[model samples]
Target: MAENMFLFWGSGSIPCWKPMIVLEEKGFGGYKNKFITFSNKEHKGEDVLKLNPRGQVPTFKDGDIVVNESNAICEYLECTYKDKGTQLIPTDKAKRARVLQRMHEAAANMQQKLVLDLLYYFFQTKEEDRKEEEVAKKVEAAIEELDRWEAYLGETKAFVAGPDFSMADVWFYPIIAQSIRMGLDLGKFPNMKAYYDKVTARPSVQKSWPPHWKEEPPMISPFKGRI
Candidate 1:
């Protein structure tokens, strides 16, 4: 019997969405999912704060073991469930090194540059908000990074890790999807545009995306007036 697993998540957070995608790929459908509402400050409540002192969403509980941090949760899932299907982290030294390198890059570099910047522009509505000029610079920098990813895709096969959809791709696809939702023109990077369409079409990707997401307006950038 599978252990009772649960995930505490927030609906609008890309970090939470990352693990949701991984769980779908792992083919574990019987686990429970509980939403921690950001609007209500539910994540800061005692129960959630115990699991993650930072009170962030995307926390996981497997039986008695608790894990926080999106990337760490992904690594745990892949290791604990190694007998299940594909190994998310390759055992080969060279491939595994590349995988770890890329995963860190995506989380540290691309995510902050693209996803967080767009989040501020689209979600935060404070009057003291920073000027659009700063936002544009960040967006442009993110675009340059996307071009680098496109170049990598052109040189590789299969997915980000080559020949298989590993955790790197799992980590990557959601950020890209969020970028699309924020109205970034993916078409500017033809390879990435194609890759985006390809990943979202996967059965796992389809399963993880919330129903409300479908009804929301397609991500468009107010900067460009179109995504």
Candidate 2:
């Protein structure tokens, strides 16, 4: 296996955490991690920008090759280092399709609502200036998405895709953690709540959790009691 694989990533970014979790699951060898600071704009510097024109964290470089998108980085590692780590996408043909289907579904149907429609309200608007009705509307939409995932997990049991901990879980766990940290009531979705507990307990997830999240207090959810 090749070494000197560099990953530039920012703490607390769910997208960045995907590859961090993937690297950890891949035994943390053949790679060097370079943590970036969002506050300092390190991700916007020439080095990262050269690798990722978008200047985003989770920009990965393997020798001369560069992979920017988080899910794509995970897929790259899974494909390139297939024999080096645990099989993330699964080998069975039918199961592989199911896993990949749910992976994209979780990103499109769940992550978009949770991050963009819901959390962005808090990030972009001050609490004092926020309109209660608008926040409630976004919360309602995000909950609908969560409900769909909760139902899926309730049926899947062991992981997001199925019995194995595959790429779907790798993609889904970080945002779910952020959702809870931002104060979404895990109890509202019993299956997801339990799944959160199980996944976070894993060595890779625990290790890859945002460093700042451990040192600083969790962020308060904008939808506190309304949702």
Candidate 3:
């Protein structure tokens, strides 16, 4: 049953990493995959477009079923492979709610601010057209998002949702890493820094760590050293 799974993924993308970590956690580490290069715009190709209309990586398949969004793929894998490996979505009602909240929060709140407003804004906007006031606010917005997580982790103690490592950690880990890679200083957020360090050492995360990141991370981030 597990053998039919396939993933189209690009290195260093948070969206791509979410499902890859889920696959590894579900003990499907050797599942078939094709590395789609973002630089080459391979994700926009016809093959990926067939499965995902937006032509995104982390276009995941399990036999006849296709799950395109990263969070959706993680949920599908958890619901399908509940017994194959770690149980990510806890059965407890209260815990399950918290897990779900954090999972989506990583995307809705965290990614929106960090990727879209901050880094993507920095990269996409032309230098001459850049306005110092708007850029400063975006940077601060990213910092405020981190402040939210820092406080959340401080309360949760071990992982994003609770003490147990669950689907929430699977969702949040990559975004946290992306923040750091973009030159967001972790020194100001102790709790988030601890969470980052702890998740960094997890086998599921380590084994699926983006290949390009290991070889060469960008020396310069779009942050312009502000983060």
Q: Please give each candidate's TM-score.
A: 0.88, 0.94, 0.94
The 10-residue segment with the lowest total lDDT in model 3: 217-226
Report the CA-based lDDT of candidate 1 relative to the real structure: 0.76
Instruction: List model 2 lDDT by residue over 140-224, tens digit each.
Output: 8888888888888889887889988989998888888888788777768889988999999988888888999999876666655
Decoy 3 TM-score against native: 0.94
Off by over 4 Å in 1: 1-3, 125-130, 218-227
Q: For residue 87, what is the lDDT in candidate 1?
A: 75
For every candidate, C-alpha RMSD to the true structure in Å: 2.5, 1.6, 1.6
lDDT of each candidate versus the true structure = 0.76, 0.85, 0.86
lDDT of 3 by residue, 62-93 (tens): 99989898878888889988888889999999
Looking at model 2, which ten-residue stretch has the lowest summed lDDT?
A: 218-227
